[model samples]
Structure formats: structure tokens, C-alpha cells
Target chain A: MSSQSVVFIGAGNVATHLAKGFYQAGVDILQIINRHFDKAKNLADQVDAQPADDLNSLMKDADVYVVAVQDDAVQNIVKDLSLPRGTLVHTSGTVPLSQLSNAAPESGVFYPLQTFRADQELDLTQAPICLEASSSETYQQLKALASTISNQIHPVDSEQRKTIHIAAVFLNNFTNHMLACAEELLSKHNMDFDLLRPLLEETWQKVRHHKPSDVQTGPAMRNDRQVITEHLDRLKNEPELQAVYRVLTESIQRKYS
Target chain B: MSSQSVVFIGAGNVATHLAKGFYQAGVDILQIINRHFDKAKNLADQVDAQPADDLNSLMKDADVYVVAVQDDAVQNIVKDLSLPRGTLVHTSGTVPLSQLSNAAPESGVFYPLQTFRADQELDLTQAPICLEASSSETYQQLKALASTISNQIHPVDSEQRKTIHIAAVFLNNFTNHMLACAEELLSKHNMDFDLLRPLLEETWQKVRHHKPSDVQTGPAMRNDRQVITEHLDRLKNEPELQAVYRVLTESIQRKYS
Candidate 1:
């Protein structure tokens, strides 16, 4: 079990990170497969695995075949995949584990619950990996593989994993958009975005310890209509941003008032 | 002067953190003035300063008098404040330095550009302190005083400071509300909030180094209508959340599509 080999079926951010993590953990990586040969080769070269452009060329003997392609392509890839003596898993948050039933007798999910950027370095060793499998045996194998790379391994079902994904949309995607909106507003005013950087850092630091409700503070939280009105007036030019500002402000006021 | 004495006119989060920062830097804290004597006495005890519930009891000979009261109270407080030998400064992001003109010939702003929680420990030494003043001498003195506690001090004017405050509301207040929304969504489904904590940490970590536009990822970023539709359907029971989901999803689509 310790010598279990893994093959990845994508060369994107999720694949690049997980492949590197498995490589660092002394696990044997068999192949890196992508529709684009160069992307496959680039990630494969880094991990000393064979790079393949065709799903037909995948090794049938690997202990695990991880389909890490786009969400729309996951079902098709799994449909074409057939592991001779191994488990198959797709690294997706939204895709259910049952989607892999046509791929292999043993199927599961191996979703790393963190946003990955190909150009940035991510320490997958500390990241939470969500696991779901078709069978108890496959679950144990998936858990073991996940344990090699992460200490925060979670056994989540399809419903729970989807719940986490939606929550992540709010935490990462929506949060980043808020900053992006701020950046746009600052850029329009010719103010340096760096002015808000330290405050951003502090806001995240506070959330790490306290609940969001406990740490909430601002004109909206304090029900300071004057400041809120001024901010709304300031944003009157950009209706989209103004709408966002108004809605978020109203939401905060509703909760606090 | 290195031995200059200061007085604080409020005992709220901003005042408590800044007064402690200056006190730790060995600046003499002469008095803590607040209408609520207990709060003033509590903060004053921490900084080894005298507590006074009366504005008339303020030490006029101090090198600086910091009016760190609420935004609406700042103008009225400055109107009543008459420092005989010290500069008058208000710790506010939106309040103009002109509001303090009648308080003293030398007036300025000493705004720490970070969110503060009174119960939590904040290292003001690393926080950005935005300074604005009525005169060059007062600006230099404020800068010197600010430098004692913070390495990241910038001289931002009233207009720029107000812009920063609006941006802070987005970066801190709006971001926290996003997390609150996620928490509410998860709680409704009997899911643990801790599941998304790691993803939240990584989101902030990525923003520290990369621009938000570059690191943005989600169903909306890819225009995955299926996932987006699914998420919206999941939130259909909560109209407010559903509205947030749609607006944010549309915002992301507008940016990346």
C-alpha cells in the first residue's frame, strides 16, 4: 500500500500542485496526461513522470488514476477511463463520486479545498483534502494517499463537499471580488492600492481567531447612516459597484440593526 | 520631542490600540478622556495615564491631543477642545484636518489604517498610520510620533484618506460579510464552518502577493453555467443570499468572460 503509484489526467493548477505534492511524498507518479502535449510534458518533466496527450495511452496498472480535468470534461474523461487493478478519482469539488462509476470498479474523489494558482507556490502538505469514495476499501486508499500530502484530510460526502465548494465561493471568490471592487475604486481615484493592503492583512488575521460576526465593524455595522450615505454618494457614478455597495451595506445593517 | 506628552480623548478600539502603541514606545500619556469614566479609566490603567470624564480636565500642555471619538462626535469634540500648547489631531479616516483648525493652530490626523478589535491584541508597530496636518511642523511632528510605533506611515490628505476609508470598508467590512454569508449558508445545512477556514486563509495569502484579478477562480470565473445554476438553486430558499450569489456571479462573469 505504501508503494501505491498514481497517475494524473490533467496538467492544470490542481494537477500541477497535487502531482508535485505526491512527488515530494516519495509516492511513485506514473503519468501526466493532458490534451495538450506540452502542458503534460511540462508538469511531467517536473515530477519525472511520463507525459501523454491521449487518454488511450494511460497506464492500466497504476494504483490510482486521478482525473483532474475541467468540471465539464470530468464525466467524459471518467467514462473513457478503465483501471485494470486500481481506483479512479477525480479531483473536483462539484462533481459527485458516482460520476466515476463507469471508469473503474473502485472510484472516489480527492478534492483539495484550496484555491490554486499555477504561477504561485502552494504548500499542499497543510491544505485540507476532501475525500469521497464508492467503497470503504477505496476510501481507505484515498485517505492514505491524501494523508501523504495533507494533515487536514476530511471525509466529506457529495452533498457536504458541494456545500464546502459553495461556501468557498463566498470565502475566496466573493471576498476577492470585494477587494477587486476596492482596487477599481482606488484606481479611479488615483490612490495606491497598497494603502489598503495592510488593512486587508489585518482583516484576515482577525478572522482566523474570531467569528466573522464578532469581528465585524464599520459604518454599516455601527449603523452610521452619515458615513454610509457619503459612501453611497461617492459610488453614485458606478451603478454596478454602487449596487454591490448598497446591497452589502444593507445586509450588514440588517444583521447589526 | 522624544519626551512629548499626549492625551487621548476616547477609549474605543482605535484609541486603545494607538494609545498602547505610543505608551509602549515610551511616549508619556498624560490623560485618557471619555464621557464614560469606566472606559477611560480602564484604558488609562493599561497605559499608565490618568482618566478624566470631563473635556475641561484635558491637559492643555501636552504635546498632542488625540480626539479618537466616533466620526460624528469628532467635529463637536474639536469645536469644544482648545489645546493651549499642543497640536490637535483626530484619529479618523474620513474627518478632514480642517475640522480641528479651531482646536489648535497646529491640527492634523493620526489615522491607523487597520481594523481594530478592542478585546484582541493588535501590533500597531506594523500597521500603516496615515497622517495629515495643517502645517509642515505639525506634519513632521505627527510623522515622528507615528514612526515611533509604526514603520509604515504615509502622509495621506483628506480626500485620499476618505477614499482609503471607502476601500477599507470593501476590503475589511464587505469581506467579513462575505464570510458571514458563507457561515450562514453552511449552518443552515448543518455543516461546520471550520471546513472553509483553510480556503479562506489561502485566499488572503494569495492576495498578499498577487492581484485579485489574476487569482480569481470559481464557477463564475469559467462561466460554468451548470455549477452556477446549481449553486443559485441551492440558495433559492434564501432570497437575499440568492441575490448575492447571482450579483457576484454576474460580476465575475463580466470581469473574466
Candidate 2:
């Protein structure tokens, strides 16, 4: 019997990270398909796998097909890719795994519960691979594949996967956005941005165990009108940042002593 | 002729941190005075110093007197101290060492360029000490004393110190407010706040060594209209945060490729 092969149905950032992880872990990446032929070929080249421009033409005996595409494209790709019985999966955060039809013999989820970027060096070991399967045997196969790359694996259905995804958005995406805002503000003033690194690192470390509200310190929280007014004056047309300050100060004061 | 004893004119966070730092560095803190003597005495006890409610008594026979009071109180406290040949220093970001007047033997600044909390573990060795003085001898003394506690010391004059302080505000205090806002928005949505930690940490890391513009990432920079709109909608009531997002997005887009 041939070793089980996994197929990637998209070549986005998620696809790149997941495929690279799978390839490095010695799993067979049977085929890669993308709307853009060149992009698919490029990603496949990195993993020593062949590319398929047409989903239907990808030799379809793979044990798993990871539909790691956009949220809008998941269903369309699944409908188009006439996969082997129960051998379809989608890696999405917000999308429910059950959206894939039951007619597909082995549909499931292999959503990595972490942010993925093409250039970023993500330690897959820290990723909690959330897996859900239509059948127990498929579930075990997904688990086995996930275990090769990640130390953390969670047996989660669509509902639980979404809750985890929501939590991740709060933890990763929005937080990064906040940092980006800080960077922009700091640069405007010709300051050593590094001055903030220790503080940001400290802030994150504190949050690992303590509540966010407890660690908040600044003029607004202390009701230091002078500092607050100075900051507000600096904000100028950036009323949104001021509103954020007001709302956050109010919220923090309410919840904390 | 007797040991160079100093007096502290405020018992606030900075005063307490500085008093503790001075005591650890083997400097003599002869007396501590405050509007609230209990607070002054509490700090004095920590540093093995005496407490004085009377301004004349605190400054009498002192080799140096430090006014670590509020922004507006520094000048008044220095004027009241009337030290005869004793050094007078003010620990403030905005206020100048010259603000203490030439009536004293020497007037200087010993501003530690880091935020201090009453209970937080402050590694003074890592903190920056911005020292300024009315005379060269006084500068050397303050620098030597600061060097005992911190490796990082700068002989920044009043104007330079003020500019650095402004920069500090942009990087530390303002950035912290942005973080607090991130926490508030995420918490209001019933999201786990831990998600923001890693992203914020990474941003700080990148900005430390590289230009913020070079490392900028997010929906705004990418011109991902869809995601930006979604996030903006999510922050509907948070006009301040929304303004922050808009202003920052514009700045990032303008600054980066």
C-alpha cells in the first residue's frame, strides 16, 4: 500500500506555511492547485511537489485535501474538486467545518490555531492544530498528520474551532494592529522606538498570567488632567485615538481599583 | 564636612524610587518631606532616612536637596528650600535644573528616564539617568551618583532633556495608552486579551532596530479595504480608537512602500 498523500488546494500564506510544515515533517504533499498556475508551481517547487492549475486534474488518490483558501472560496473549491470519498478539509478560522457537504467521504478541519504569514518564522510547535472529522478513522489520520508538525493538537468541532478563532483574533490580529499604531505614533515624534520594546515585552509577559486591566498605567487611568490634556492636544485631528483613550480609561477604572 | 546628606521634598512614586535608588547606592538621605508626612515617613522608613514636615528643617544643613514633586510644584518647592551652599536638584521631565535658581550652591537634575510604580521591580541598572547641573562639579556628582545605580546616563541639559522627555512620552506613555485601548476593545467584544500580547511584542522588537515604516504591516498598509472596513465597523462606537486607526493607517501608508 502506498503511503498516504495530502493535497493542498490553495497557495495563499496559510497554504505556504502549512505546506512547508507538512513537507519538512516528511509527509507526502500529493498535489497543489491554485487559481494562479505560477503561484501554485512556485509553492509546489519549495515542497518538491507537482502543481495543478485545474483542481479536477490533480491525481485524486490523496488521503487529505487541505482547502486553505479565502473564506469566500472554500465552498467553491470543494464543490469543484471531486475528491475521493471523505477526503476534503478546509483550514479556516471563522468558517465552520460543517459547511463542507456530508457527501464528501472524509471532510474535516485542520485549522492551525495561530497566525500564519509567508515571511514570518512561526514555530509550528506552539500551534494548536484544531482538528474535526466526519469519522473516527479520519480524525485519527488528521491527528497523526498534525502531530508531525505541532506539539499541540485539539479535537474540536466547528463550534469550538470558531470560539478558538475568535479568541485568536483578539489575541493576535488586533494586538498587532495596536502595536502598529504605537509604531506610527512613536516615529512621528523622532523617538527611539526601542525605548518601547522592553515595555511591550513586559506588557505581554504580565498578560500571560495577569488581567490586562490590572497592568494599565497612564495619565487617563490616574485622571492626570495635565498629561491627558497634553496628549489630547498632540492627537489633533486623530479623534479616534482620543475616543479609544476615553473608552479604555472608563472601562479600566470601572473594572479595576 | 560631615557626610553629604540630602533631603527629599516629595514622597511620590519618583521620590520613593529615587530615594530607594540613592540609599542602595550609599548616598545619605538626611530627610524626607511631603504635604503628606505619613507618605514621606513611609518612604523614609524604606530608605533609612528621617521624615520632616517643616521645609526649613528638611533643608537645614543638607548637602543636597531634591524636589521630586508634581510638574507645577518643583519651582515652588525649590524656592522654599533656600539651601545656603547646598545643591538643589529637581526630578522632572519638563522642568529645568535652572528652575531651582542660583540661590543654592548648585542646582541640577537627576531624572531617571523610566516609569516607576510603587510595587514593581525596577532594575535601575537598566534604567537611563538623565543628569543636568548648574555647575560642572555638581554635574559630576550627580553623574557619579546616578552611575552607581544605572549604567545608562546622559548629561542632557534642560532643553535637550525636555525634547527627550517629549520623545519618552510618545514612546512609553502614549504607546501604553494604545495598548490599554486594544485591551478595552477586545474585552468589550468578549474576546480573550492574551491574543494581543505576542503581536505587540513583535512590533516592539522590530521597531527597536529598524524604522517603523520599513516593518509596517496590517490591512491599512496592504490597502486591504475589506478587512479595514470590517475592523472599522467593529470599532463603531469607539470613535477615538477609530480615529487612531485612520490616522495611523494613513501614516503607515504614507511612510512605507
**Per-residue accuracy of model 1 over B45-124 as CA lDDT, tens digit each:** 99999999999887778898899988999987877777677898998888778888887869999989888888888878
Candidate achieving the largest lDDT:
1
The most accurate candidate by DockQ is 1
DockQ of each: 0.69, 0.23
**What are the candidates' C-alpha RMSDs?**
2.5, 4.9
TM-score of each: 0.92, 0.76
- Interface RMSD (one decimal) of model 1: 1.3
The Cα error of candidate 2 at residue B76, in Å, is: 5.7
Q: How big is the positional error of residue B240 in model 1, measured in Å on the Cα after superposition?
A: 2.2
Which segments of candidate 1 are over 4 A away from where they belong?
A81-85, B1-3, B46-48, B82-85
lDDT of 1 at B131: 93
* Local distance difference test, each candidate: 0.88, 0.68
Instruction: Write candidate 1's Cα lDDT for A72-178 as tens digits.
Output: 89987777666677998998889888888876879899999988889888878668899999999889999999988899998889988888888889988999999
lDDT of 2 by residue, B1-257 (tens): 23456788899888888889889878888889987779988999998889877776664787778888877777667665566677888888777666787558788988877777777767777677788888898887777777768887877767656555544544444455555566666566565455544444455445556644465555555776655566566556766666555555555455454
Q: At residue A98, give the lDDT of candidate 2.
A: 70
Worst 10 residues of 1 chain A by lDDT: A76-85
